[model samples]
Target: MKEKLYAIYFEPEDWLAFRESRRFNPGDTARTVFPSPFPFYGAIRTMLLKKYDVKLEYHQKPNLSQELLRKIGDESQPGIIKLYGPFVYSESEGKRKHYFPAPKNVYKCENSGYKTMHLFDTKIKLNCFKIGLAWIPEVEGIKEVTESYIELEELRKLQSGQSFVLCHAPNLIEEVKTGIALEESVKRTKEGMLYFLRIYRFKNGGFFMLTDSEETVKEISKIEGVFLGSKQRWCRVKVEQFGGNIFQRIDSKNVAMMLLTPAVYDGGIVPKEGKFDDAIVKAIAATKKTVVSGWDYTSGKPKPIYHAVSPGTVYYLDKFPKDDETVVKQSYYNEFGFGRFVYIPYENLKQCEGGEQNDEQSFLALC
Candidate 1:
């Protein structure tokens, strides 16, 4: 049976603390800006369980009927729920705009213009590093687009191989609070245990998520709010039918696969054997890798750590597979919305005036 898709919006009621996996100690700062998808996975499941009056027992599995178990499965397995985003959205001047991660291959120039990197493959080899195919900028002094999110229309323009400026989302204000750890026995502040914690408050918009599950949609309809991240921060929920098609099909053989969410693979950043169902990966442009770990409510322990390829990473493929669904379906944590991606035409550097390939000299210089 096909799952029903729903676009869910989360409006936060207060500041949110989406902390990283670093350990906190005295005089240490707790960074809390990176929003991982695992929290939403837990929050949605918790909301569903709460809606159905299912009590969660610590260090033990909750008693569930066969029907409920099939909908929201045990700790070891996820049933039918699948998530797709934590994308950004805001309303301005009576218009709502969606935002997504900018592709890493795109760069902003000093003159406020945008330029994309070009794919190059050479016989250059470095010690202990096998340099196969790579994406390199033709000209020097181009800056990377940092902390940038592209508007939906701008993203569409990019997917269509057109020039587009990078769009910045509303400023996220960070609030820092200093506090001392308290002793458990006496409830007194522990000496020399002061720490500063930083949290983020959105200036205008919250987050948007894509979910598909008939049972989840039915249960979520009964609830008005759910706790999002740490401190039980409340967020009002709004559900509607999602009709947007962000992925575009290109007629060219060369295709660019851009990840909408972080993906985990058994063979690290690249898929096993460097192929996506026979579509050979030619090159890749990725941001800094991140480690994903979360607290398991069922077992009262931390979930196993998985190294993930960051969102906005672009994988250049020689051709689009006949079945593109096989790419994301083979990723780890697909039920939690990891490995979501979109296809776009691969744009190459334009040719020089005399029928020579542009950036040929730059590519050779880099080699």
Candidate 2:
């Protein structure tokens, strides 16, 4: 599934139809008009542009103070100011009001002299039947992030500096939280639809699919625990596109794959349906490869290749490296007798198309 998985976070109005219209691949997907202004906004938009060839940008509400809106602009693009609040959500004569919920844990604004959500419909994206954005972040991740957490003081503080707000947010969570989710504009290819479990994050990374149809969507939606994998929904590839050891020996790989597969299987946290925390664990007793993940930001955390890798335990790279360095330095070459070459899926294993968490673990496919 990692092969078909990608999550991008983009700003309101970042959608450049002029630039993206040319890139649309017929079979990919994109989800746009996310709930908030997340840093992931740019990354999600970029990936969608490359994959679905569509623009999924966000929009902001006009009710905010000019000063406040200006501050947010440092981190975002211009938002779409509106004519009225939710009252004007639709121009249709009979459509009385937009759905409303009694506000909770509401806080009055001290900085702007207003009340909680005083500026109703004060977000970037406007609701339109033509657009349908889905919510499944918590559904796919090891943990979930929500709006309730965001609507809190802690969340407000987290989003303080990068205060990019959206207009016309879809009512998914009751409140806000520390992390905001920016959904990319989705382009449905409408082919043989299927869901995938991209094992890139598993002990031995690989991609797998569970074929389903429109009927499956309704059933899956009711699961309440599972997440919608990708809007582009694709079929899986038989070959391995990502995963494996960074510096492994020829004989050690089979051992590695065996140890890792069960860890992901046993942990049972791989979104068999979304459940968090202890649901996932390392199978140190089962894995063989020294799962080494690479980091682009910090110096990097220590790779726990030895801890959970055993015959029974599954190996998690927590970030396994997938770069030319890993392949070039760890190649199965005869010239050097000491660091003897380890054969791995070099060309095919490194190019992963998923989001930030792609290298977090080494996924293995048991099926």
Candidate 3:
């Protein structure tokens, strides 16, 4: 049977606490919106085990839990599932509106450096300074800093219809929670008060599709364990047949892959410079990097620093590869869905197209 794609929405009840990298502790930080798909992957796997009794020994305990160990019985196989998003959302007029990462090629520079994203919708060049204006702190109230940095207006113009919210949204309320380890307890935080970042709850989540598990989807939806980013952060989810047209159609071979969640590579192979490697560039037109790191659950230790191709970073493919099997076998991270992306068909921007027009065209594909 040909499996169908399903949409699963995860609405966080409270501020989500996700630490992508464990490099520092005292002042832990969170990726404002960028997320890794592995955590969501693990969530789905756990759902299969709990809901439909899927036998996934290989995934549970790769070493001790193998196919040979399952000779005892033929438990139900996990439904083949593929996921695409953890896209942000915003509630307007009492309804949830979906948002993807801002379109690429319209970013402004900050004092630190250039920032990139994987969940963009189109491909077109733009002068960052001309789009928006920014303020320079050192210049003492100097606001004409577009030459070096992007202003809030232009950035929002690019992200307008998209569901992404800036880290510094005025409506974004945050709270600092303090905790302390009990005396004589064997907890990681056995020393002093631990502070946590808790932002006001908002509506933003992701989508998933199960290839072989039609019946399993029903059970999975009823299981009440669907989450967006981290296990600790529980969310309310809705599962149904996907109805939107944001995803690229099957026939479109030349595609634009926008990362909804942060993708993990073997050792962070995404390029940092404007140019990409020939082989990589052959398939991908442009690429950028987003650095992230987190704790490894198994080792209970901080994960290595990861120079991931950040979520919202866009990659243009001259020609989409057709051999799915070879693509998986040859690429280390492809199968894992680390750098997974969605296809957006190409369209040339009109000469008169500006921010508003570009934003309008972004949703045209959906229409």
Candidate 4:
């Protein structure tokens, strides 16, 4: 019935390691910025069960948890609606600033057409131009290229002083941790187990919303902390509520779907390009490849190496095809924040907000 919003904040003790691939050898364990949403879904379900005094199981049956989670549905009831974040939170001056996923369509301009190059200069430019309107990218710092557009309609949710914490979207930094490999039979330490390097750098937080149903807010409010993500990579999160909707109204005719979290599509690594339904609307401007992993319930093992469209990818639709049913029917990939996005008027980029310079005292505090 009513709308309820909850934000999850994770404060790591020191570092967290989300193993990207299944390889577990010393110096072979790698990590990524974020993990797939299936683990998060499992984590929340575990929390709910714990709150309800349900027994925790070592091994859960296939799809059994899905049926159990169905009981927590809202009035609209199309499964559970979830939106994960790739936003970056850092302090600017005395106030805090939020950085959302900049659409992949925005790029560095060369001459007339387009060029893909990182902007590494004295200062980054906040000014941007839309497709067909620009003349020079050689002069301007950053420019939006052909068919390059970002949706801001749903972003109106952030306009009303509602702050959100991002999940699984971390700037990866590498660090070395030391450990000893043990011998099973002799019960002694082995050699060549001195140290290993891992990508320990990541921001652990997620911002999501839930429909207030069956006293959902009541149970969640009582929660002080919950362990999210990998068990070995223990992350104690502080769950709290903030004001305003994280998503805004999508009233524009031409819209783009941007990935805030990595999405899994069928078949090949590249997301297939096609229309919504024959010619209702066509899909254009899919971005490059991103790797993501998840825990499999059926086999009870780490899922195979999978590729997903990275966050900040912009998928242009011919028009915002005015059929809610069509979007819902084709939105199977959106369950885990894959094809989830907001609709903005297909327009040029506006200057971003909150890019202030902070002193050392302020900068050190966030670290």
Candidate 5:
């Protein structure tokens, strides 16, 4: 039987901490508005085990019966389950709307309008090698929309090369609390050991994800709430069938792939050979790399460190891949939805119909 897609919403009951991989030290801030997929993976898996009446001892011992093991795989592997997102969502008037990271190729102008970057076929010499294609902004005085998000309707308009306005993301507030460390043996406060913990509380909305795992649907369907993030913060869980598609494939020779989640590639930010399936990468617009690592409860150790390409990164391709399956097959950690992307026509962006465009002379002067 084919698996069904479901939307899982997490409405937080209190402030939540989504810390990065960096060690939390005295005077350091442990806060983030967005979190990676690792935490959600662990949380859902644990909940599933609890629903099955699996004992904690079995997690460390791996002594489950063959049938039980098949249902929920032993440590180090998640059985037949796949996860995507931790995207932002809001509910109003009994309807829920989703938001997504804005594509890097899109820029916001000083005049409150948006513009798309155009790919130019020119060879430029770098420190060691030369690059053939580069993405150039259509107008001057525009900044890349990196730290912003767009509503689901805006994303659809973007995918279809239509003019769309940016929507303000839900507000997120950070609160810091102080604490002092104490010596465990002496039961006394450690001298000069003060720290501040920063946590986030959304002003209006919470995070959500899309999953097709039958086991997850079955277990979460029976529960009204679940604990997530640091301190086991409680969050109301809402699951519903999702019928719409987020990605719309465009048939074009020049296509752009926008990352919806951080991607980990063995060959660094760009894929090996600058190729994804049958399409060759012509240009790229990406943000700084981020380190992704987490604690492995099953093994009682830290997960392997990975340098991930940030979400919202856009890769211009020579053509659309022969098949979507082949493109996904080339990505790493795809089961966790790490390299998820949407393809759109690249040439349409060059028209600059949504926003003002500079003349050829001015653009050349800026270049």
Candidate 6:
């Protein structure tokens, strides 16, 4: 690390107040106690080190809390981060109607009978610290790679349970938006991204996930396997959480399935509408053709109205419309606006429109 007197900023009071309302006193309550958090973390950390050689360089124990306080004192936080502890996703009603869009941090990891809280030892036998995930950015070796680390497609496939989370960086979010992370500023001009220029999938259909760059969105009209979103745009990042996995962090089946490498591209790109459900259905119906994408306008407002690309063509609706189809004027879309559709039918079953049956039930009824 090189150093010249650069810049150092501090936030005094806000740091002290950070834990005000959200603070959990493990000592005070039996229900909220996380007695073995440190040990469990150590066990997990050890396991990761043994299996993947992943090491975390945390701030020194005694002063870590102080460091966290100073850094968070003034800096703005990430947009709409939800912590899925496991239970938060199960509760019904009251601020939980898929409280995803509200941009609030809802913890759902409490379920699975698992609970964890960050700890900062104020004074250590040999050190002083402030410890909590102050800045949990991924690190390769001791060097901090920018978001350019992972390819966007691989990350998205990881979301679909097909690929492994081998490597990812904040930059992947630009030419590629990250699955679990986003930079402070998102690049929206929609440059022709390399991931969008080409398409690939398993012909036999054992398992594979699709990913692309924004350039692919505009170019889908030209690309064969690619599907366009309602507005015909490539996806930002969409996450799918898990309930049971013997694996830690991102659960991947990389060991079982084959991998797809991304093609490299040069130059700029214009935006196109990525594929919609009709397109996906058509692709699936085609047989031997694999499509990877999320449904646009399926959720949200201004429900994306679909007609067949051609009646005979088959496509799949990855995310069908939710019960509450609301149109939101999101600048994310090319000013055309979009509908907030539901991607995971099972999760949104209660809120599915028609209430007649869930996707599975509907499919079953058909059968």
lDDT of each: 0.69, 0.20, 0.41, 0.43, 0.67, 0.19
TM-score of each: 0.82, 0.15, 0.51, 0.56, 0.80, 0.16
Top TM-score prediction, candidate number: 1
Q: Given candidate 5, what's the lDDT at residue 126?
A: 36
Give the runs in model 5 whose Cα sits over 4 Å from its true position. 1-4, 23-33, 57-62, 124-134, 137-147, 174-198, 212-216, 251-253, 299-301, 348-367
Could you tally the backbone clashes for each prediction?
0, 73, 14, 4, 0, 66
lDDT for residue 106 in candidate 1, whole number 0-100: 79
Candidate 3, 202-273: lDDT as tens digits = 534323332224644654566565544433667666676643333333455334444544555433333322
Q: Rank the candidates by TM-score, best first.
A: 1, 5, 4, 3, 6, 2
Best by lDDT: 1
Error of 4 at 14 (Å): 3.5
- The candidate, 4 or 6, that scores higher on TM-score is 4
Write down the RMSD of all candidates, one decimal each: 4.6, 26.8, 11.4, 12.6, 5.2, 27.4
Which candidate do you rate higher for lDDT, 4 or 6?
4
- Model 6 spans > 4 angstroms off: 1-142, 147-153, 161-328, 332-367
Better of 5 and 6 by lDDT: 5
Per-residue lDDT of model 1, residues 93-134, tens digit only: 756678888887777677758866666654333332233454
lDDT tens per residue, model 2, 172-285: 211211212233465544322221211111111111212112322222222212111222222111211112222233222211111111112222212122111222211111
Q: Lowest summed-lDDT stretch of 10 residues in model 6? A: 11-20
What shift in Å separates residue 279 of candidate 2 from its native position after superposition?
Answer: 22
The per-residue C-alpha lDDT of model 6 at residue 300 equals 21
Off by over 4 Å in 1: 1-5, 23-34, 57-60, 123-137, 174-198, 212-216, 251-253, 349-358
